[model samples]
Target: MAGCGAGEPGDVRLADGGTFRQVLGLEIPNFHPYRDQVAAVYSTLLYDSLVNVTPENKVVSGLAGKWSATTTSAEFTLRDDVTCSDGTPLRAADVANALNHQRDPALAPAAAAALATVPSFTADADDVTRTVKIRMAAPYSFIVRLLGTRPIVCPKGIAAPADFEKVSAGTGPYVLTGYTSGGPYRLEVRKGYHWGPDGARTDEPGVPAAIVLSVVPTPATAANQLIAGDVDAFYTPDPDSVRAPGPEVTKVEVPAVTGMASFNQRPGRVTGDPLVRRALLAAVDPGQAAAVATGGKGRPARGVMAPAAFCSGDTVSANRPAHDTAEAARLLDQAGWVPGADGVRVRDGKRLRLKIVTFATSAQLRATAEFLAGEWKKLGADAVVEEVTVMAFITVTQQSGDWELALGAGVTGSLPSDAVPFFSGPIPPRGRNAGAIDNAEYLRLIGQASALPDEASCPVWQQAEAALVKRADVVAVAETTAIWFARKTRFQVAADTTIVPTSIRLIRG
Candidate 1:
C-alpha cells in the first residue's frame, strides 16, 4: 500500500475473450521443470501435473483424476478425458515415461530430488483401468503432494527430449505456440480444456483465453508497464521497487517464501570456520535487512517457512542472529583475526575479505547484499557483491570455490519431505545442499522424521530445520511475500507459488 499509487483502469480484453498480458521479472533460461524455478512457471502453462495445489493449499487431482498412496508406493489413475494439445490421449505409458524422464541420473541432484520418493514406476496398460504404479525406496507420506508438483510430458516429447526447447507436448489448458529464451512467450488456450485440477474447466468465467508472457527483468519497468495499461499483471517479491499502483489495481501477497543467504561451508572456505560464521551471522540484523530489502514492505523471517506451512515454526528463533558489532569483533579476535592498519581484519597476511554472489532476479537482494557488506565492514570484514545471470548463479552455486556467501530465494511446501533435498542432500555441487553443509545431527534428525508417519514427523523436522539455522548454515533474512499487482485482471496464485496463467481471468468491466 505504501508503494502503490492510483492509476486508471486499463481495458482488459483483447480481440478475443481470453487473451491478456503480463510481465516476468527474469528471462526464462530453460523450460525443463527440473532445471530451474523460472522454467517451472512455463511448465505449468504448457503442462499440467498429475495433481496441483490450490490457492487454499488443498491438493487436487490434475491429469490423474484420482490417486491413492501408501508409504512405499503410489498409484495414479489417468483421466480418460485428458489429451495432449496435439490430440494424443493420456495413457499410462506416457505418465510412466514422464516419471522416468524426471528420474534420469544426468540431472543435478537438487533438480532430480523432486522424485526422491519414487525410485521406480510401472505402467498398467489396461484400457479399462489406466494406472501407473510408483515404487519408492522408502515409505514417504507426501508422495502424492510431491508428484503433484511435477509437470508431465507426453511420450513423444520424452522420446525426443531435445525438441522441448522448440516445442512443448503437454496436456495443460494452454499450448505453447511461440517461445524465445529471454524474450516474449506466447500461449493459446485449448478449445475444450476440461481436465484442470479439481474439475477446473476452460470455460470457467475467470479463466483467461490466452496469455502472453512479456519478459521484463526489472520490477520498476514491469510496474510502469502495468500502470500504462501495457501489461495487466506483474509479480515481484520486492513490491517497493514497483512503487505504487492506482486504486484500480489489485495487490496480492504470495506467502511461504524466504530470501536468505547461504554460506559455503566447504573445508577451505572462510565461512567453513564456525567462529567466523557465527561472527558474521551475529553482525547483521534481519529486521533491518528485511526493511531495506522490501523498502519497509516486508517482514523479518521468524523461521525457514511461513506460518501456514505444515513444518513452519519458530525453530530459527534460538539461532536468529543478533545485531551486536562488539560480539562479532570479539569472536573474530578470539579466532585470531586482528584489524590491520586499514581497519580490515587480517590473519596470517590474508585479509578477511569475502564475496557474495547474487543473481539479477531481485533488486532488493542486491540492496540487501550491499547492506550486509556494510554491516560486515563494521566488524573489519570486507564483503563485496557480484551480480550475474540466473544461469551463472546456478552454475556458481554448484562451483562454490570463489563465493563465501550467496543471496537467493527459497520456497517450501506443506510437507517436510519437500524441503529435505535442500537441507539434507549431498554437499554442494553434488546435491541441493548449496552450502556444502554437512551437519550430522541435522541429517540424523531428518532421517528420524523421514521414518515417522505423516503428521507425526513435524516436531523432528522442525528440530532439524532449527539445527541448520543454529549452525549459521543459512542466514534467515525475510519471510518473503510475493507482492503482485493486477490491473483489469484477476488471478489466483497457489499458496506456495507465484501466478500460473491458467488460473488468471480478466475483470469483466
Candidate 2:
C-alpha cells in the first residue's frame, strides 16, 4: 500500500497496487439538494433519473425499466431486482414516498412547485406489480420528459422528508459517503448495487470502487488540478481554460445552456422603462461579449430558442442585436433621455446609471459585466458590476426583484416546454423569469405551445420568443458551450445535448 501526498505530481500506487487514478476537477458553488441554488455534484452521481437524455439528446430508460403515458396520466414499472446502497429493496413504495415527499409543500417548496400539476401518485405492491401511477391536472406532455430526466426516488424507510436532505439514499450505482452543505461533496461506489441498464454492470467487475467530487470554485484551480493529475476531469465555462496547454487532457464541447441578462419588468427602477431596456440591449455587443466570456467558444444567440434546433432559416444573424452605440443613443434620445453634465443619460430627473449584478464565482461573468459596463457607458448610460456570492445573488434576483440587470445562465433539457417558465405569467416566485415580464399575448402563446405536442408547436414557441425579444425583457447573449476535458486516453466520454457528460466507458487495450 502507498500513500499519495497532497499536491504531489505524477502517478502514485494505490493500496491495492492499482496504477490507475482518475481525478475530476469540480467547480461547485453549493451542494445542498434543496436550499442550494446550484445542483450538487454529488446529486448527479448518487441519484439516477427515471429517464435520462442520451448522448444523442434522445430520451432513454433509466431506473424505471419502462414507462407509458396517456393524455393526463403516466405510469412507471420498477425493476424487480434493484436495491439501494444500503442493500434495501427499491420497491414501488419507495418511489411513491419520494414523489409524495417532494410534493409536500412544507418539506420541499422547490420540488412542490415543479410537481404541483400532479393530482396524485399511487403505488401498487400487490401481486409483485411494482407499479407507480400518476394523475395530472391536464395533458402535461412535458411531464414524461421531466420525470424521466430528474426524478430522484427515495426509499420508503426514510421516516421524514428532511432525512432525504441530509442522507444520500438512492438506488444509484454511487452513494454519498461524505458531504459539506455549501462546499466539498464526495461519493463512493455502492457495493452490490444491482439496478442499471442491462449490460451496464458486470457481476465480476463490481461497482466503480470509489467516486470523489472536490468542489474547487476557481476555474484556474480546477484546470491546474486536472493538469497535475489531481482530478480526472472538470467543467469550465471559459473556452480559454479548456484550450490552455495541458498534459493528457481532452476537451469535449456541447451546446451550452443559454446565458443572458434579465431585467425585472415590474414598475420601479430603470428596468421598468422599455426604452432603457432596449437601449441596454442595443448597447451590448453579444458577439464580442461571447468571444471574451467564453474565449470564442460560444456562438452568439439570436433568439430564445437555441439556434442549433428549431430555428427558422429566415431568422437572420444580422437581425440578432449587437453593440450599436449610435442606435442605442438614438433610442435613448427618443425616450426623452438627455445627457447630463456627468455624461450620463437622464430621464425625468433620474440618472440612467444602473447596477448590473452577477455571480462572483464565475470569472467569465465578471469579465463580461465589465465589458458590458464599458459598452453601456459609450451609450451614455452609467453601469456598475456588482459581484456577489451565488446564494446572495439568487436571493436578490428573486426576493427583492430590485436588480436593474443580471448576467446569468439558463439550463434547459428540451425546447418549447423548457422555454415556458421564462415567459409565462403568474411566474413562479423566484423562478427563472427574474424579469417579471407580463405580456398577455406572450403568456397566451406559451399556453398554446404547451398544449401542442408536435412540430407545429415550433412556430408558436418562435412567435412567443420573438415577442420577448421585442420587449427586451431579457437579452439572449450566447448559446452555452459545455466542454469536458479528460486526461485518460483509455476512457471515452461523450457530450449529451443537455450539456451533461455521458456514455463514459473504459476502452480496454
Candidate 3:
C-alpha cells in the first residue's frame, strides 16, 4: 500500500478491482454507545454527529447541511443523501429517533441526563424541499455543536433500548462488520456515505476497506505487537512508551482529554467540610503529579476549563491558593481536625481518612493517585488509593455514589455545553456530576450560559468556571498528551485539539 500526498485521496486497487484493505490497531474496552470509556473511538468511526470539527477546531457540516437559531429554539436542515450501513436512507425521522433513544433511560442513561435541559425535539420533513427541521425546546447556544456530537441512529435496527448493547448501527464513515464483547472489533466502510466532501471515509489508505480495533491492556504486549508488525497503531496513555527506542514506527502526540479528581460533595464525606476540601487542594502539587504521571510530558491545570482556548493570559494575583503543606495543615486544624498517634488527622473520634478510587487501566491516573496519597500524608491526612477496573469504578462511584473521590477524564470540543454535565447537579443521579455536587448557584449559572448565544456565551462560561474553581468540587490536575506511533515514515500526520482520531487519512508523503 503506497501513501498518498495531502488532500489527495488514495485507493488500494485489488486483484478484482472491487475492494480495498486498510488495517490499524485501536484500544477499545467495549462498544456500548452510552459509556464514554471505549465508546469515543468507536462512535466517531461507526456513527455520525450532527456537526463535525475540523483540525483547526472549527465546526463544519456532518449529518446536518446547515442550521439556524432563534432566541428560543434552533433548527437543522438535514441532508438527504446520507444512508445508514443497513442501506436505509438517513432521514429526519432517524435523527428524531436517535435523540429520543438517548433520552431513554435504558438506552443511554448518562447522555440523557446530560441533555435533560432539552425539553423536546420535533422533526418536520418536506420531500420536495429535501430538508428536515429540528425544533429544540429552548434557545440553546451550543445546539448545533451538541447535535454534531450526537450519535445518529438507524430506527429500523433498534426497536428497543436493549438492542443498543448488542447492536451497532449508525450513519457514519464506518460500519460494524465484526465485533466481540471483550476482544477485537472490526468496521468496514459504508459505501456511498454522503456526510463529508468525498463521502465520510477516514483519511487512512484502504480506510474505507476495514478498521480492526483490538483491546490490549498490557503496555508491554501492545508495544511488542507494534514492533513485531502485528499492528499498525496502539493506544497507550504513557508518553514514554511512544518515545521509547523502537524501529519501523514513528511517534506522534496529539492533545487528549484531561484527568481530574472529582469530589463527591455529599453530607457524609470529608468533602462536606469546605476547609477540608480547601486543605486537600492546597496539599496537592500539580507540577509533581504531572511529572510523575506523564514523565514530564503533561501540563498542569488550574481549573475545570482547559487552558488551550478559553484561558486568558491576563495577570491575576499570583498569591491565590496553591501547593502549601503548612497552609493545608493550618486549614485542617482550623476545621477541627486533630492529628492522631498514627500521624493521620482525626475529627470527632473518626479518622480523617478517605478512599481515593481511580481506574486501573490508565497508567497515568494510577501513578498520580499514589503520588497524591503520599502528599496528603504530609498534611496529616490518610489517603488510601483504591485501584479498580473502569466499569467497577463507574458503577460504584457514578451510579451508587459509594466512593469518596475518583480519578476521571473528559474531552470537551470547543463548546462550553460539552462541559456542562460535569458541573450541573440536577442532571440525574448517574450524570457526569458523579461528584454528587448540588449547588443552586452553579446550576443557575450553567442554565444561563446554555441559553446565551455563542458570542455572548463566552463570558457566561468564564463566570461559571470561576464559580466551580471557588467551590473546589473538582480540581483539574493535568492535561493529557496523546502519543501516536506510526509505521509509515513517508507521511506527515496532522495535529489537532480534538482527542478523537481525525485527520489520520491526511497523512501524506
Candidate 4:
C-alpha cells in the first residue's frame, strides 16, 4: 500500500502497478459498438474514438491527430503509430468500412445514433494519406462531435461481429483478455500504447496496470465495497442508500436529466393527442415523482440537454406546463372525455387507460413508474405499471409500440444535436424514436441549425428544444445528481457518469 502515490502535495504516494477493481453496476452484454448503443458503456476501455470533446465544445486529439469538418462533410487523419489490440497496424480502410457499415440502418440499429444526426452518410479511406473522409446525408452542425466519439471496431471484429459478444477489437490502451456471462471482466494494459485523450499515457505514475470489472446488483452493496476499500469506485442515483462516506472518500455529483415522462405518440395511442399529452404532464407532480426517483436527492430538471452541454438552456422552466389536476380535468373534459361512474374517463364508450413502462432494474426506477401511474389514476385514467428487462425495452417501445408512457426512457447527452435522432428520426424497428414524435416546427428548426457552424447555431438549436417541451411531447420533471464515489482511485466522468478510462489511477497506502 505504501508504494502508491497521490497527485497533490501533502498526500500519500499511490501505487503504479496494480489492478483497479470496480463494481460496474451496469450490464455488458456485448462489446460490438454497432450492435447496441450500450456498447459505448465500456467502449473507452477497449476502443478509442477519432477525437474527444470537452464540456466547452473544445475538440481534443484522440485516435486522430488532426481533423476538419463542415456542415455536410468531414475528414480525420489517423495517427500512423496506432495499432489494434492484436498488435497489427490499424488501416484507414478498415475503420472507414466500419463507419460505412453503419450506413445500413439494419446492421447498426442500436448504434443508429450516428445516422440519427444525418439520415445517410458515406465514408472512404485513403491509405496513402492515412485519412478517413465522410460525407453526411444532410447539413450537420455537430458532425465532428458525433463521428469523433464513435468507437472504431478493428477489421477482425468487423468481419465477424458475433464474436464480439465474447471478445473485443480496437486500438485502446487496454485489451480484453477474460470475460464470461454474469462474471467479472478482465483487461490488461497494452504496453507501449498511446493515443489517449489529452495525451494520456499508460505508463504514467499512479496509472493502473490492469482493471477488473464486476457487476454488483445493489447500490448499497457496491457503495459498501467502495467504503471498505474492497472496490475503487461506484456510482448511484440513490446516494442515500450508502452510509455516510468518510473524508477519505471523494463524492462527485453529476447533474443530469434523469426523470422524464415519455409519451408514446404512435397512431391510435391515447397519448397521441397533444392535448392529452399536456394533460398527462400537468397531472403528475414533477417534484414528487422526482423525489421518489432519487430518494429525495434531486433538483428540478433544466432542459433536454444536461448543463454540461455547450448549448443547453433553461428550456423547461419557460415551456413546461404547471402542475394542475384541475387543469388536467378541464383539458380532458374539453376533449369530450368525461369522467364515468367509476371515476375513469370515458371517451365515446372507450375507457381511458394508461400503462407506464421502465427498463431499469433499480427499485427507485420502478417506484417512479408506480408514482406516475398513481397520479394518472387521480385524473380518472385506468393507469397500470409494467417493468421490462433492458433487452426487451426496445422490442416493447419500438417494435411492439405498446404502453402509454416510459418512466426511464428519456435521452441524456452533452450536446443539443444528441437529442435530434431520438426525437426526430424514423420511428422504431426502423429507429429508436419509439415515441413517434412528429413535431414539424422542431424538425424544421433542426434542419436550419444543422446547416450552420457550431456556436453560430445555438439559437436555432435552443428553439428546437423549446418546441419539444412546449408541446408536452417530452416532459422532464427532475434532475438527479448521480453520486460517483471513489477511494484510492482518481478519474473523470461525463455529465451522464461515463468514466474516462485513461483517467483512472489506482492509489495505494
Candidate 5:
C-alpha cells in the first residue's frame, strides 16, 4: 500500500447492537439544516423534506405523498400517517413553519439565501388530507429542487433557534440521542418507520440500529482505523492509497464536490481591478494546483458545478483561463504595475500583493493556497496565505475588505439554481454574495433561467454560467472526489452529495 494507513478496523460490532461509526475531521458547528455539512448529514437522518431528488435528477416523494405545481405556486399533499421521531403526527402546519423559517429575512442567512426564490408558505388540512401550498414571489421553475434541499423540522424549532441543534423532533428514521462538542455524536434509529422515499423502510435487514459520528482530526489516523477494522468506513484524501490489498475493504468515489477560489471584487480592492484578477488567473493553472492539493485524486474542474450536474455543459470549457506567466506579467505592466528590484510588482508605492483566506482544517485547501502563492511569486505578484477556522472563514467571506481571495469547496445541487446565493445578490451582511459580483447581464440571465421550466432553461443557464467564467468571479479548481474506504458497509453515495444515510446497509460477512 503506497499511501495507505497502517492499521485496520477489525470486523467487530460495538455494544449498542450494530452502531455504524463514521469519522469527521471537523466538528459540526450546529445541527440546524443549513448550519454546516455535518448538520446537513444529520438532517438527512433526523428530518424529512417534502420531496427528494434522485441521483438521476428525478423528483421523488419524501414526506409528501404527492405534489403538483403551477407557474406561481406548488401544492403538496402530505402522507396521513407520517410521524416525527417524538411520536407526534407530522402536521401541515409544521411544513409551513419549516418553509417560512428558511425564507425568513430576519434570520438564518444561509437558509434565507437558499430560499430567497420563495416568498411565502401556507398550510391547510381536513380530516382526510393534509396539504401545504407554497407561493413563489415569481415563477421559480426549480421550486421542487429548492424545496428538496430544505428539511422540514418540527414547528417547535421555528421559535427556538437552539432547538434545531439540540432537539430531535423530525419525521425521519433517526433521532438525535446525544452530542458532545468534540466527538462521539450519536443518533438512534426509529422503529416501524415505513414512510421513506422510494419505499425505503427502517426495519430492512443490515440497517444499523444507530449511527455514531466521531471526530478523528487526522486523515491518516481515520484511514488506519478503517484498514484495521476499528472503523466501518471513513473518507480518504486518495482512495487508491488507502484500501487494503484484500477483498475485505472497498473504495467508493463520491462526486459533485468542487474546490474553488473566489475573488473579492469590491471597488477599491486589488482584485476589483479586472486586469489583476485576470493576471492572477493567468499566472497559475488551476488543474495543476488542484492535482497537487488533492494528491492527484481529484478531477480537474470544468465549471461551477460538476459535469454530472444537470445544468453543466460546454459553457465552462469555453471560458477556462490559459496559464501564461508572461501574459500575467504583461497584464500587470498594462495595469500600471512595474516590477521593482526584488522582482515584486509595484504601482504607486503599493506592491502587487494578494491575501487568500483558506481553511486551516483542510490540508488539501491549505496546500492549494501555498501552491498558488508560489505560482503568483513566479509572475512577480506576492500572494499571502491566511489560514483560519471554518467559522472564521465564513465570517471573512461575508465581511467586505476582510479578504482578497478565498480558497474553499462547495456542495452541488441537483439543479443549477441552488447556486444563486453565492454568485448573485448583494454582498453580506446583506446577502450571500461573498465575491461582490455585480454583473447586470449575469444577474439578468440567471433570473431569466430561474423563471423557466427545467426543460427550457438549459441554454439560458449555459449563457449565465459563461458570464461567471468570463468574469472569473469564482475560479473552479477541481471537482474533488470524496474517497470513501469501507470495511463492511454496502451503500451508494450520490454524485451531488457525499453522505446518504438512508442508503447505508451493513455487509454480511
Candidate 6:
C-alpha cells in the first residue's frame, strides 16, 4: 500500500459495470477538435485519429486499417465499416476534409503552428475502395506516425464548428451525450465500437459502459474523492501528502519540462544580443531553479521535449551553459554593459533589464522567477517579474512585445517535431514563433530531419535541439511532474499527462 509501481501497465484488469468517473480541475469551454485552447482532454476522448501510436511508438490502426507513407506522399486504406457518432459513414473524403480543414484561418495559434510543418495537403479520395492518397506540399518523413496526434473530424464537424460543442461527431468509442460549463460532462459508449488503439473495443468486460468527466476544482478534494472511491481517477499535484493511505489506489507520476526561460530575440531588444543572452544564462543556476519550482521534488531537464516524447533524448544536457557569475559579469562587461550608479548594468544609456513574464496560477513558477531575479541582481542586471491571468499569459507570449524573457512556459507535445514552429518559424501574428528566433542552423537541421523517416531522423533532430541551447534561444531549466491517482479504475499513461482513452478499465470490488 505504499504507491503504484512505475513499470508498464499490467494485464491484470478488473471487471465492473459501473460508469467511470474522471475528475477534472478546469471548466472546458469548447469541444471543437483544434479550437479547445485550454486543454484537449475532451477532444482526445471523443475523437479518433487515422492512426494511434502506443507509448512504445508502435503504429496501430484507428480509422485507417492499412497505410503506406513516404517523404512526399501517403496513401491510407480506411476500414470499410467505420461510422461516426451520428451514424454516417466515415468515408475517405471525410478524412481528407479533416486534414485540409486545419488550414482554416479560424484555427488557434498553437494548433496552426502544429500543422505548419506540412505546407499543404492535397488529397484525392476513391470512394470505391475507401482509399485516400495525400500529396504533401513538402517532404515530411514522420507522415504516418505523426497522424497519432491529429484527430480526424467527421463531415458533421468540418462544416459546422458550433454543432460539435454539445455532441461529438467523431468515430471514437464514446459520444458526448451531455455537457455543462461547470460540472459533469457525460460520455456514452457507442455500440460496436471496434476502432480503438491496438484493437481495443467497447464490449470488453472491464471497459466502462459510460464515462463521466466531473469538475473538482481543488486538487486536495479530488484526492479525497479518489481515496473514498467516489471518483475513479483524478490528477493531483502533491499526491504523496494528499492521497489517502490505502491499497486500492494507484499512482503514476510523469516528468515534463518546467521553469524554462525563452528570450525575445527580436531586433533592438536587449536580449537580442547573443552575448547578453549567454551572460543571462551564465548568471542563473538551473539546478536551483528546478528545485525551487518543483518544491525540491523535480528532475533535471533532458531535452526540448518532455521525457516521454517520441523523439526525446539528452539534447539539452550536453549543451547547457555552466553557472558562473564571474563569467556572466565578464560577458556583460565585454558587451559594453557597465555598472551604473544604482548597480544596474547599463550600455549607451539603456539599462540591462529583463522582464520575466510568468502566469499567476502556478506557485512553482512564481518561486522560480523570484529565485532567478535574485540571482540576476548579483550580476548587476535588473530582473522584473510580471504575473498575469492565464489568457493574458497566452496573449503576452503570442502578441505582446513587452517581455524580454518568458518564464516557466513553453511548447509541450507528444512529438519532438511539435516544438518546430515555436522554436523556428514565422514571428507572431503570422506564426507561433513567439520569441522571434532566427537560428539558421536550427532551421536547416530541423528541415533535414523532418524529411526523413522515423528513427532515422533522431540524430538530425538532436543536432537541431543542440543548436537552440548552444545559442541560448531557450533554457531547459529544471523539470516538473504531474501525478494521477486512480481507484476502482486502471489505465496506462504515456509518460506525459495525456490520458490514453483506450487504456481505461474499471476495477471490480
Candidate 4, position 224, lDDT = 80
Q: Whole-model Cα lDDT per candidate?
A: 0.72, 0.58, 0.61, 0.79, 0.72, 0.76
List TM-scores for all candidates, in order.
0.89, 0.81, 0.83, 0.92, 0.88, 0.90
lDDT of 3 by residue, 1-509 (tens): 12222223433221111122223233444455654434643477667777776544456787777877654555667787777777777777667666666766555664666565554565556545545566767666666656545776677545653455545677776666676766567766555555752234444443325556666665556667767766556545455543363655666555554566777776588876768887887887767876766667776764454444432221111322577888988999999998999888888999888788987766777888888888888888778998987667767776776666777654343555555666664523646666767666666776787678665777776666666666666666766665555443222222223224323442322
Please write out the lDDT profile of model 4 over residues 1-509, one tens digit for every residue.
01112345247566899988878765677767788676666787888888887544578998789999988899999899989988889889987888887666676665665466574778899999999998888888877787777788888887888887667888888888888777588889988877888677898877788888888867888978877888878877657666787778876666666656678999889999888888888897778877887778776687877766768788887788889999999999887789999999999999998988885565777888888888889899999988886557667877888889876634666778777777877886666678998899999998999899778889889999999999988877677766788787777776446777777777676
Q: Which candidate wins on lDDT? A: 4
Comparing candidate 1 with candidate 3, which one achieves the higher TM-score?
Answer: 1
Regarding TM-score, does 1 or 6 come out ahead? 6
Per-residue accuracy of model 5 over 263-378 as CA lDDT, tens digit each: 89887678888788888888887668778767787756767776667777666556756788889888889999998889998999998788989877677778888998899888
- The top-ranked prediction according to TM-score is 4
Model 6 misplaced regions, further than 4 Å:
1-15, 39-41, 107-111, 215-221, 224-230, 236-248, 427-429
**Model 2, runs deviating above 4 Å:** 1-42, 113-128, 156-158, 180-183, 197-199, 202-207, 241-243, 257-259, 303-327, 361-363, 410-416, 422-432, 454-459, 489-509
Model 2 clash pairs?
23-231, 23-232, 24-231, 24-232, 51-148, 256-480, 256-481
Candidate 1 local lDDT, 269-341, one digit each (tens): 8888878988998888878888877667777887776556665777776776577878988989989999999
Flag the better candidate by lDDT, 4 or 6: 4
- The candidate 4 region of ten consecutive residues with least summed lDDT is 1-10
Q: Is candidate 4 or candidate 5 better by TM-score?
A: 4
Give one digit per residue, the lDDT tens place, for model 6 in 1-509.
11233233364556756698998767677777666645354566888888887766778888888888887888888888899888998888888878777666574333565676555767778888898888878877677876534788788777777877677788888888888887688898888988888678888777777899998766667878777778888874434336464787777776677766889988778989889899988887777777887788886677877777777788877787788889999999999999999999899999989888886656677777888888888899888999875567768878877889887544566666778778877877667778899898998888898788878888888889889999999977766676778776667775446568777777666
lDDT of 5: 0.72
